[model samples]
Target chain A: MLEVLAERFNYAVIIVLMMVGLYAVIATGNLVKRLVGLSIFQTSVFLLYISVSKVFGGAPPIFDYKDLAYDKLDPNAIYSNPLPHVLILTAIVVGVATLSVGLALVVRIREAYGSIEDDTLAEADYSLELEKGV
Target chain B: MSASDITQYFDYIFMAMLLCIGIAVIRLRNLFAVVMLTGAYSLISAAWFVSLDAVDVGFTEAAVGAGISTVLLLGAMLLTSREADKTSLGRHAAAAVVTIAAGAGLFYALGDMPVYGDAASPANTGVGMEYVDLTAEQIVIPNVVTAVLASYRGFDTMGEVFVVFAAGLGVALLIGLGGSKREED
Candidate 1:
């Protein structure tokens, strides 16, 4: 029963992490906190992909002549799927780019508004908008 | 239920949880909460994609959904406010309902997807066979997915790179790249 329950435990863990991150993003009004939540959420998804790429009873794409037996191929070898890993590498690069851009935006926002709080910025922008007459 | 039956039920449960999370995300009163919920929604969707065996897509979803999107949203949140407009809830609900209905209809329309590992699948039977079979000689890459993404679909990858560059340029234009110089009145 335990084996069955844990058959796809990776998915379960990913889901839980996702929920926590989502909750954090929603519950926190602080800008940095929301970014943390987003990172958590994304990490879980990455885990899910890596886990799913695992093929049971397949050998790693790497070749080890010593591991190969004479008579018949070993049925127990498990080769992980490498495609998802490569895709994730690209995604990580993208994520870094996004992070730097976002941080830049935050800096600009801080410069424009003395405070970073959502309410304060809104009020400040509102007055500016008011000055412009809608 | 047998062990496999239990696993099947768990799948249903996961799907239910995903739907509930989606509802919670859209219903939340705070904008920050909503953005976070959106991340959760994407995470859950990534899990669902993994279950369907689209592992590469799952990876992309996880990174974009959780890591970068949340950061961008948080940054944007700092410039705005978290409080949901009290008067807009009704309109939001209407929009959500419409979106859900449309999405469901589209899903129903695509109901003939081949079952996992079907030998006769287009992926297994068509030109995919030649590619999969010839991987040893043609690309020498053991990973078919990599071959497809980097070589077969190379131009699409270029387009994606262009999109990212354009987005960066657009943001730079909005915020004014380099150290901000206080405008001389």
Candidate 2:
């Protein structure tokens, strides 16, 4: 049981981080806080992919040409999976792009509604609806 | 102890730090502190990435996560309020319930996962190995990650660039490029 726990502990940490992010997104009323939660969530997923790509006794995915000549390359030379790293490189860029857009929307919300809190904005909308009905 | 043992200990330390940061981000009411903690969280995660043999990913994470994201969040903070309003108990309870349920489900699935750093795991074999083996002959690049990212997956990278462009366009269209220029006009 202890060995299993040790082996799978990375996933366990990731899941906890993910849960914290999700809770923040759901529970926080502040728009900026929600975006922070979203970022935390996105980052946890990044960690997960990188963690999955790790190989024991492996080097980083950079080839040492002197030690690993093209003609006499060792097939047993271990490297962490580069495919996931490639995927995550794009993901980190996309994550930032998404974050910038989200922040822009939050700024726009504050400007238009005069409040960034979800509850305050909802209450204002409700009052506006009541005024229109009367 | 062996090197792997030390690496494992480092992983544990990083994970514990991340957990503490995550909880702090959640419990803190001050937005400035939260933003700073988020950047620290990213930097620590980047360090963890390096230990995991993902140098390129770590480099990118440090630049984008800790640097750009923190700046962007600070800019947004300037436009918005600093303190988050108190959330009600009921809402907190509901979110906790949902998060716990989701976490339990994922935890149950974790049993079937390959042990950490098992080289023969499915993710490390097959196509990943193929890229590692082929890069020397095909791309002649020292960095297998660079070779695969720029060559084998060039189209994907192009698509990602387009996505980033679209996001920038969206932000500009929504709020303009910076300063009071858009507001003044």
Report the number of the highest-DockQ candidate: 2
Model-by-model lDDT, in order?
Answer: 0.54, 0.90
What is the per-residue lDDT of model 1 for residues A11-127, given as tens digits with 9 covering 90 to 100?
544555555556545544445445545655565556555544544333333324343323233444334454555555455555545655655666567677855556667799999
The C-alpha stretches of model 1 lying farther than 4 A from their native spots are A1-134, B1-10, B87-97, B100-104, B107-119, B178-185
Index of the highest-TM-score prediction: 2
**Given the true complex, what DockQ would model 2 score?**
0.72
| Weakest lDDT window of 10 consecutive positions for candidate 1 chain A | A63-72
For each candidate, the DockQ is 0.10, 0.72
Model 1 / residue B13 / CA error / Å: 4.3
Collision count of model 1: 7
| iRMS values for every prediction | 8.4, 1.8
* TM-score of model 2 (first chain only): 0.91
Q: Model 1, residue B101: displacement in angstroms? A: 5.1
Q: Candidate 1 local accuracy as lDDT? A: 0.54
Clashing pairs in 1: A26-B33, A42-B66, A58-A77, A58-A78, A58-A79, A59-A79, A60-A79
State the lDDT of candidate 2 residue by residue for B1-185, as single tens digits: 11253577799899999999999999999999999999999999999999999999999999999999999999899999999999999999999999999999998888788778888888788798899888988887789998888899999888999999999999989987767797888
